[model samples]
Target: MRTRGSLFRILGLCLLAGALVAGTLLPVVALAGVVTNEASETVESLSAELADEPPPLVTTITDRNGDPVATLYDQYRIPTAAEEISDAMKWALISVEDRRFYEHHGVDWKGTVRAALNNTSGGDTQGASTLTQQYVKNYLINVIYRNDKAGQQRAQETSITRKLAEARIAIQLETTMSKDEILVGYLNVVEFSRQVYGVGAAARSYFGTTPDKLTVAQGALLAGMANNPSIYDPWSHPERALERRDFVIDKMVENRKLSEEDAERVKDEPLGVLPDGPDKPAANCVGAGPENGFFCQYVEDYLLEHGMKKDDLYTGGYTIRTTMDPVANHAAKESAEQQVDKTEENVANTLSLVKPGKDRHEVVALAANRDYGPDAAAGQTEFALPSAISNVTGTGSSYKVFTAAAAMERGVAGIHDTVQSPSRHVSDVFVGGGEQCPTVARGTRAYCVTNASEGGSGSMTLQTALQTSPNTAFVILEEQAGMRAVLDMANRLGMRKTMASNAATGGAPDPDAESAEARQSQLEFFGPSENSPGKGSFTLGVSPTSGLELANVAATILSGGVWCPPTPIGEITDRDGKPRPLQEEQCEQAVPEGLANTLAVGMSKDDLPGGTAHAAAQGVGWNRPMIGKTGTTQHNGSAAFVGGTPQLAGAAMVFRPDRPYGGLVDGGPGNVRATDGDSGNMFGGKTPARTWFGAVSKILEGQEVLPLPAADPRYERVN
Candidate 1:
């Protein structure tokens, strides 16, 4: 590796080098730390180990189409062969960095003497380090960082003792390795900028081209910047970079490497920096920027949960191909950033889309707007990630389908069953059915229930209840179906408690683990501290989940009840280029076809005025037959829409205003506006519904527009 201003860094090389060449160790023996005989033996030993080093490789990540999307690197560098580097670049570096590079053995005695005299004479101590010595110093530094940080600090010490050890090593390095090997090694370890190490990476970052393509003028500019990458930044300080470039060209003329005419001509040329865009993209998924950053994290989490090793991801040199559709991914990003106003704190949008099927379901898009990092939020560790995963507090009315389906699956109710309801519904059938479900309020036992105001008071059929998503209708249905039945249906469909660990949630899910009572509280015996939900509130979506899972649920219903848990990775290859085995396909028919179809029909009524997510169907503009549901929780804490066609399904959710119980957006937040200016606050039908609509519409643009399955005769409204 190369070091800028290295003479001061190598502590005491001059005295030892002079003494060794003079055939006497007495003058420098004490400062050198070893006797001449011992030093000679040590140098010989290091010579044999230099031949075993290997070139480092970088890992790649691509989309399902085999298009490169990002790279994961431990060193953020690419290794280049000595033969491939351009002569212009090679000469330019040699001309500016080490004039007597070819003439020197390990160290340049003449230049060394001249530097010592200059320092003794009180002139600024000039750099006398030959290219070989610098390579040794940089090598020592790199090796030390691998295991001993304290050694690195000592290696950088500007003391006589440190320099003697470096000189001794350079002596060994020069004997076993050829001059070209030393040059290549130095180029590979040089730090050109922050997290950017090596001439190869620097060339690509600044010029958008390989080292072999650099012109003489371009080569000089890059070489000049090596000493001070920050100060000579062409992007930020063009004038200073231009001045250094010209100075290097002038130095070449003085050294007679270039004729006066040639140097003058080169000096007048422009900096010729890479324009418009960067050749080197971000180092990994986090660097993919705000548009796809969230999904990149999703892909990472998926791979880790599967079989890929975490250590292998950043350094194992493997390639991973994921099933992310560019079209839908971009659509979701636009909907989050432009379509939705996410200016306030804790307000973010996450959208996930799935391809319909009974077997492996391809996840199309899992995108969010905000860029994420360790410090993404002011007081929270994460915001966008939680939203994409839908691991939040409540899902609201969007959860009505699970309760409705569970009742039908168990024969407690039919799509047309006229379940008795009321303007206000209480869930405490366990304690008292006639009064409001008692919940503690202001330190006293209180009874409570309220309708969405949109659902007028009455006994409602399953079809009407689903279309309107009324709190009362869902509560009545959940009570009739038995709490166990509703809880069983939700668990079977793959909803997990928000904070459960990944290992616990993944693999085959257990639908019956939580008895209906377990859904309300951690305790087996119901008590006041239970949160006492029972089955009635299950329809209200009290649990936390993710957009990808929810979208997969919509795809499940569209596929005639078959469910395929969302899978991100299509294939992965080891460093050896062989495909590695991944988890087996997880596919299940979680719901009965008849019940699933009945529920799908209610969502397919988007063409009707009361269909909660009608705008989503219209957004596609294809007139394709599709189905979905809208959800808005209490306090408007969260808004979500899960919509689907036979071929495509997606879910979008928005959390707003950042507080324990801040205002919510059912139709639309009064301040938030749509494409046409108007307050959006309803149910999941408004903003999030529109986002789900926009993404699915674009995702299914060219695919076949299949109609929903023919409804069963039993699906007609029941009295």
Candidate 2:
């Protein structure tokens, strides 16, 4: 009475059932029958292709104290082992999805025959997939074909080939893995809702609990969602979800896994989910909050730049422990914001700190007054203002430290050696003929430089020049030390990014199509040729510079001339808890240790009387022995302060971020200009120095005070 199509469908199902049965018992001989041979081959081929690929999982990023900073993931999943799942959850899943899960060799032949007969007789569509078979199906769609639309479609299609493939893989899995293992794998791989995968993530998302802590009702609810997460989503369709949940409980009772009395009681309970629904992990760096977001982004970028694949960071389930000190970072953020309101339109304040060591220079904090987010109109930005070289501007006289180190290294001048601090000096060797250096002398143009204050007009010891930061004194010292030496020293002592090609100008210069700005950048930083005499303004810190680089320069001196890359990562581990090696730049002695020690001493008076930062230091009640320097740019466009104790080195910068050429002035809140101006007064000793002191004092509070290394006599006087 059946049609030919129906007869063929029934025949095929019967033959598959027979082959599955025979393969488990009679083995080779049973599958040799002509009708079952093709089915047998398909099963064999699919079993070989079945691989236990790990699912995409969440990657957690934490601070130095092991507190979570952020979490990243492709699919929000946290895989749990069989033992980590509660018995109630396991039983509920088995009861509703597959009652005979323990007894099945994988393909329940009787169920297959029943489904075949019913479908051929024009009844509703039915599936005979066992738990292992469902696991294989979900694995194929979510893992193997995750990125392939066509493959995922084929895996989910209601075709005989797909079902047979699932059956074969399921049978193979049963032969290899225990029932508990297969069941847990299914639970871990299945999707509970959009962007939520596995019971581990599901428990937290739905009920704000863990897998092992699920109650009977919670277990039944989660188990019901595996059938069709979208249709049974508790947040979207509460009534249907509750109905499905109760149905699952009833099934548990029928399967004898739960008592009828318990089922009735649980069915009357409300869907005890979090009022706000799913509590997903924080998304990327912004989730780290404004206080730590900048440091979080730096950590993310540092890892990616150092050979970690983007996919690996999102899905590798890595536990990245960074060097961000919560105390230091909080202090830095509060200090920066306190110095300059985050909503300030024209001016920006930023700070960076590094813990100095001969073997490691851990970046403790990187913070900006601007809130770290995407809402730029609200004065929030995700730009790497504290560390990126592109965000750097003229750091004023902070560059003098490099010139001083170069002079000492070349035996031209020592810390105690006398240098002339003329009010104005015209260079004989270096030429000047640009907007930056337009002062001409005689018929030919000469590079003329002047002191910032009238008091810097007489001869003084190199130590006095460091404290007062006289422009002409360090400029004259730069020439004596040779331009190349100073430039080299800057690069060696943590100005690596600044000395390289301008990242904002599109990397290395191209003579054919280079812009005027790019050409000027090259000339100012690198000069026309390595052999050419350097710019006279070099010692005056006329070039663009980074805050973090300035802090590391101080760190290098504090670490006895050992310059280690400012690293944010403290440790990294894989999902299995194996330590992963980080490719960090090695530390090297950038200058003689004795010279560095003596230079630290020479620079130590900046926070005392007669020094630029003395007022700021005294205002903060700072009495600790520390090395410090303050710098103000030529046009007062930017100001910076760098200082350090034996434990920490840090730098602060206040700049016109919107208009780099526009000058800053006092008389506004926090002693800063509300808007940019043509030319006005703002010094590193004011807002920048105070910001530095504010953060450093809080960071070093309660810690033992440590003394700096003694000044080396070799570099204390001219030899």
Candidate 3:
């Protein structure tokens, strides 16, 4: 109102003041808050990661007999990561994922800025995750910051919220951990799926190597996968995985982690992986002994029952200096495999034989043939061995040897003791009202006859009866020894208990619904028992004994009463390679050396002229001496050859093919044939003896075979 100039100046001043106010207030209200590089410091904290408990693993070991084997374990888990992580792998990881991993605190600022700008310009959401964020997400917790109200709600509501809580926690982690420790924790906590957790496990699963052995390229590939595991799975997405790997190579070069030339070459390298699924210890091969799988399993079970831990097998790095000779085990398994192969075409059944020894036992052979299934036919199940833990039952004839040995030990019988065969029977009957039958009778008087019962082996003495394996003769002698003497003798030989636990339990009826059980229930081979000592069948080898038990008994004879517990394992060491001390071991000497020598001498005499083991005797190379025994069961079920040299002793057995068919698995007439033709005349002397000879010949280093220290005080044989 005062004038035109004054009015204009006032208006200008007002506009200027308003502009100043807008500028000052706009900056204050539009402030995006502090952005001083929200990078993590070394003082970061973190939540405790969940520790993984792995699966339970089992291990096993065995004797040549394929008996209850031994076992080993480490936390019952095969820790893939613990075995795989190494320094080489660490370097490779850095080379691929974060070359400046050690130099940077928790973020690569330049990388983050460029990524954020690109996302903003493109109107899309992307990430600039550094190694620290990746580790935090995978191991510590997830990190999520967003702009929407719902997003804010989510940040405060879910595990992601908990994860944010963890960021606060992780920021404190740096205070408690070193850089290397954090990295290790990251590697250990990361998951590669398939129940495999940790870089160590991934190394083994993917590359068949430990972290230390990881190739530069391999490390890069593995590290790169942590960004997106499913999309980069090499096994499932080879092409995509390779492309991702090449991208890593390019990034590595961009960051100067690798020279350009090296990077280019690595990018072009074709991806390859091991054909086998993964690399690990073969549990099927325990103690890494010569025996096959079945025998190993047997030994494993026995050891476990005897106080050996299951974990000691794998991680224990046990130096199982076994009593078994590898060469012998191989031979026995091979021979048995061949025989069983030819005999069984429907199911797999193998035989494993062991020869007892003074220094180390010998494996005669492990035999399995395809009579079970396609797997068996393919040789996959031979060592996989069927769990025959319950299939124990045989005749009682084997008990006679024990009876004879016991009588000798008890001073109740001697080599000179003679009992007329075919005479009136006088054996003790365990059941009600015993019968009085005559000895195997000749025309008018009883005379000893061989087990064959074809003709009289002549009026042979008691020792001669043992040498000739005369069934009639032993029966008559047992009668004379009296029931108490025979029973007492059998008990001492360790045949007091039934082989099958079911038989030992109550004389219960068969609960097995399987047809095989129904059929087996009717046979003596099933080993049905009403009492400890049955009334009549004790004369014949009618008691079930494992190949191991048989070998032990024969070993007792060979060792002259010294029952050396068969040694299958010798040494165990810790992860640090320190040897583990074992508890003191003690063994019981079950018989006198004199009595044992008598059994050995009597058995060895079979290697002489006109003995039941004449075939075995012929194989001994007339230049040296040998001792052996042959037993053929009724119905052609089992044929056995138990024998040894001065330094070694062993036994072999072959199940005849004449077994009646039970089911599709019974391996009927058309099932398959044993390597040896299933001729009616087949005997243990043929296959078992030959296999035993093959194994022993290798261990003996061509040494002369000798008998036990002579039992004949009157007649001495040179040692």
Candidate 4:
């Protein structure tokens, strides 16, 4: 074991070496002869390893109007410039931590010698780390070795070697960085408490104010915590923290940073910290609250999918401006909850809205009746109910609009072309109606379809067929347009995700499946297939779909055929305010303008008399010229409504979301059932239509009224 005299000799040699590197002259010149070449080389090597990279900072997300929505961070740090910090804070820190901070190069040799003698004499343990040395130590622990526990421990270990290395790095840093720069860097990197870093964040946390506005007492309390945060935490040990704060104030008085009268006056003041604790902003999308959380989630997903790394999002200090419209989102959320109670188990009502334009389709709102959170017992979930196709069921007859548009595009039929709408019809080419319909001679199971009402039993114009949403009429119309054409039209008109995978399986078919039957089953369920004409029910919307995509489909038609991705990001900038590039808008002409115009006109009568959604439209006193379609799946498993004016488009869906999902039956407010639908009580005209109208009316209240595009005579040809 080393003797006490030998330990003191070693400590003296380390202090002398640090003094020599820091350009300080000490009286102990004889001890310099004891420093070895290996010790000198170690200091040089460790100093060279110091990098000037920035520390992790909070990333802020804002709405279109630049209002803050949420903040994300690995460490709750907000880097502030030297001039932005108040003089009280700098004085408080300097007075308490190091009185000779400006006079010393990096190490205070006199203080080190004093501390060394006091420590060896068994007096109060004292630290002689200068402010610059403290900065070097914290930079190594919080930034360079942030992910390495052992490396952090080594940097913080109570050893002479670690102290020498820190001293050497601090000396080198003073040469390259200005005195104020070094001071600000130290202030920004040091931890004030758990997960809280930087004087900027500390000022806001402890005093509920900005760094430039901190008072003398508040600055003293925060600076005092830098020595031992856990012991001086105002939230946990108020009395001890007050004592520390008073000590700092006395130090300020002694150092001439403040008058004795001012010091005493400030010390007598109460610790004005937030009553609860640090005023940390909520972290991540969940902190965006229930109303805007769904839209926030979609923005996050869009950024990640476009190329942003998860780490970059949390620590890059980026300012992401999203296209969330507060008014529209609030209306949608309130309307959805009015239609369906948020706590109602497994029953969800979701809505999405998109602004229509040829150059950009900005998604402004995504709302669901269920609260966006992580508590299942409280009926809250983080699932992307309005945007994810896998979270929804079939959209029912809302898809007939796609088939009608396909017919108009292919020249197979026109808006005014007469089509046979029988009570029942059997599809000979497509397969699988199991036992309900017999197979034809083509050696394929027949697909049988029937109208939802007895009134759909005569030849009617294609426009009338859409208004009534006759299942058999659209199924026959799909055969005329060719199933492939209808499926392609749906894909081009914003059903990309739905057409890209099998919704029943929630993803693409598994290529490594053990049996061919399993693969075939996955391929044929609710999506396009390779070896077959697309499902005959494609026109009837008997496939799981996303509300955002469905709303975009309306937006596509409103834009006169140009299809643009529903983008949520408005702009992005780096920490220094330089604009950053995002994924370019991908807009394409999916169909001829004339064809889209005529189709929009064909769908215009849906909210008028004799249409499926007429009652819901009348209830809202809606008089704007618009296009709309209503759909309800077989057995009432789900109901949907898609509607739009020239300015905006929206879609709403009501469905059962539990496993082995079943039908939703309407029986007045609380009497609704999710498991049984044999009575066929629910329809798209009820909750789904009401939700769409209620939200859209509020969103479009002040906007200029625009009529639907005029129909092209060519597409209105008589059959």
Write one digit per residue (lDDT tens) for candidate 1, span 463-518.
Answer: 77777767777777777777666666665665532323121222233445564433
lDDT of 2 at 444: 43
Which regions in candidate 4 have their CA more than 4 angstroms from the true location? 1-52, 109-127, 145-151, 158-161, 237-243, 246-270, 375-379, 440-444, 505-534, 667-680
Candidate with better lDDT, 2 vs 3: 2
How close to the true structure is residue 231 of candidate 2, measured as C-alpha lDDT? 98
Q: Which 10-residue span in candidate 3 carries the lowest summed lDDT?
A: 39-48
Task: List model 2 lDDT by residue over 476-525, tens digit each.
Answer: 88888888888889889888767775523423444555565464443354
Q: Candidate 2's C-alpha lDDT?
A: 0.80
Candidate 1, residue 210: the lDDT equals 86
TM-score of each: 0.72, 0.86, 0.65, 0.86
Model 1: how far is 268 from its true place, Å?
A: 5.2
- Which structure is stronger by lDDT: 1 or 3? 1
Off by over 4 Å in 2: 1-52, 110-126, 144-151, 258-265, 374-379, 432-445, 501-525, 530-534, 666-674
Indicate whether candidate 1 or candidate 2 has the larger lDDT. Answer: 2
Error of 4 at 199 (Å): 1.7
lDDT of 4 by residue, 266-379 (tens): 988999998888989776888888888899889888888888888778877788999999989999999998888898877888999999999999999999988887877777
